[model samples]
Target: MALFLLICLVLTARLWSQDDPWDVASLRAIEDSATYAQQVGRADQIGFSLGQQPFIANVLIWDQEGTLLYPTSDGFTPIRYELTALRIKEIETSRASAERPFWAPFDHRATKLLTCLHEANICLIYRRAELEQELGLESDALAKVTEPDRTALLAVMSLAVVITGAALLWGLRPARPAPAAFELIADQFIARRGDLTVELTARDVAILDVLMKRDGAVVTKDDLYNVGWGRDFMPNSRALDQHMINLRQKLDPDKSRPHLIHTVRGIGYRLEV
Candidate 1:
């Protein structure tokens, strides 16, 4: 069961990892270039292309004066601006002075974009005018798409737990009861007297064979222990007590007053016909 749970957890982690689609450094680089393009008032003139074929999308550029420009989608448009050089210098200064790496602040943004790509299969476009509206819709769609089937997975795990528990229970079942030693010997004696009948477990028959061979004498705890449990000496005396109890129950007409096998206090038991 533990092994099964471990396997399930490993599979789940692999599935989640496979589903994760995003490269942080790549996204950060794209964002940085986009920021530079926007600050230089050339966002409309500049276009970002992705993939092998270089598919382009129209982007709205903003100048330092907050002036918006819209570029034609036909081709690249050159925008003349004196602040472009100053913007580059400012970016260099910002990079040098920044306490953390340039990509650190945008980690969450990159992760969100990656998740969107994995679930919604949508391209993230940072349009100046429609940014808010597109972002809201994209985030909502991504949330809906990425939501895993937790309820079904939990049910399956619960079922597995129940099955494992049941299997362990079945495997650990106790041994079945065996006939008493005295009853087995008595049955053998009766069988020799023109009545062939003996119904006893192998363990009970072995004990009976040992006692009958001794000819009704008292069998010490050690003697019974060796023959019954195959031990050199008495190990657990309670085992002998239980076996004797089973023997009395099977042989004695009134179990409350055992007649066939008699117990000697603090010593052992004797079998008498």
Candidate 2:
């Protein structure tokens, strides 16, 4: 899950970096094309310089209200939308015609940019960012990653996953023969190690099973919740701790050498074999 989030953040950053050139171009486009002196209270563009710049696209500026400061030709209507932090907003792009592609409510990823025209109410909207996978990079990087590099990256990731899985499996390999005379009589819900005997409930057995399966390592609270309740862990719940305290008292009636079921501070409990 951490790895997944890291990958997502990296992907998001790369996508954001692609907008550097386009942002400058679009903002310049907005600034130069301003008909209102030094900026007024509405969204408008002054330039007729479309199809000229490589980075800039069909620029359209609008105020908080969806009124087009610069009128648009071809079937394009400004639908009311609330502007927030997300750079891209889904807007409807449809014609009044009943043709195959010119139907109603065609969703387009609109790039709504906050320009310096006003107190930041004026915004320049475009469908520029969704043009490609990685915006300004080489096309071959997206389609074909030069074979060798792609193969190497995949190989490293696979090796990492395999090593991680093996380490976890080796560490969590369950202690066999019932933790040295701490015998669990499953049918009776009773555990016995020498003179000490601990009676367990079904839930206690489930939780202990999960902990014992980890050999001697600390069993996480979340993992215990998963095995014990068959549900996600709730942070507010103290049931696991209470159960472990009771089980520990039963397991260590005399509290002899090498503590059984020792709490690892913020983590869960660990048992000595």
Candidate 3:
């Protein structure tokens, strides 16, 4: 399950990286602006609309005969020459339509879109950034860019479903059944549930036997001492406690919370299962 999620994550990243960052919506917006500029004709309206779009760097207006009407200055001389050359070529060929917009390379950072208005008898030029900013507005731009990557979207959704399913399966899994019983065989203590066993000292075995016989009932300290030391060689309370500590540690290293042997406070200890 983990491996599948990892594979999906890697595949999703690859698909996302392969997606195109540019969208046609940006081009459509630019085309509409250029068409409107040519229809308005007034320099003020055209300039105002152009100024509103931060993506547009400059504009050029050309008459039907390919004469530069706007930007009287020689600043865009190279671009003007290219536009006229293309216009003249189109005119000579008589193949290109005047109603639709034409695309031409501007430079490394920008491109030029020429939209010719047949009724107005003039062509509107727009020098726009390669990545148009008008339509690239955070979430809206991301949605437009990723909408075409259906494969990547599907991979992400599948990963979410798999993770949810794994969590559900884990939560619904059956609990492990507790050990049925325990028995002492020589120096080894064994649980009936499985082959789980632990080696024990003679005193540890005797002390455990007494507790096991009483089951969950408390076995007193005197009883444990008699069984562990046989009265004649009985040790002090601290010694018996130290032996019990060692026994509990051997049974379960986490003596702070012993599962098999539980301390019964003041009295003695009891065996649970």
Candidate with maximal TM-score? 2
TM-score of model number 2: 0.33
Q: Where's the lowest-lDDT run of ten residues in candidate 3?
A: 157-166
The candidate that achieves the highest lDDT relative to the unseen native structure = 3
85-133 in candidate 3: lDDT tens per residue? 4433343232133223223223222234333323233334443432344
CA lDDT of 265 in candidate 1? 41
Q: Write the per-residue lDDT of candidate 2 for residues 178-258, one digit (tens) a residue.
A: 333566676788888776777889987887776677654557677788888776556545787787878878787776623
Provide the TM-score for each candidate, comma-separated: 0.27, 0.33, 0.31
Whole-model lDDT, candidate 1?
Answer: 0.36
Which regions of candidate 3 are displaced past 4 Å?
Answer: 1-181, 187-195, 254-258
Ranking by TM-score: 2, 3, 1
- In model 2, which residue pairs have backbone atoms overlapping below 3 Å? 33-46, 33-47
Worst 10 residues of 1 by lDDT: 114-123
Tens digits of per-residue lDDT, candidate 1, 59-159, equal: 22333343334332233443221123333333233333333222111111221211111111111222221222333333322321122345443332211
Please give the CA lDDT of all the candidate structures: 0.36, 0.41, 0.46
Better of 1 and 2 by lDDT: 2
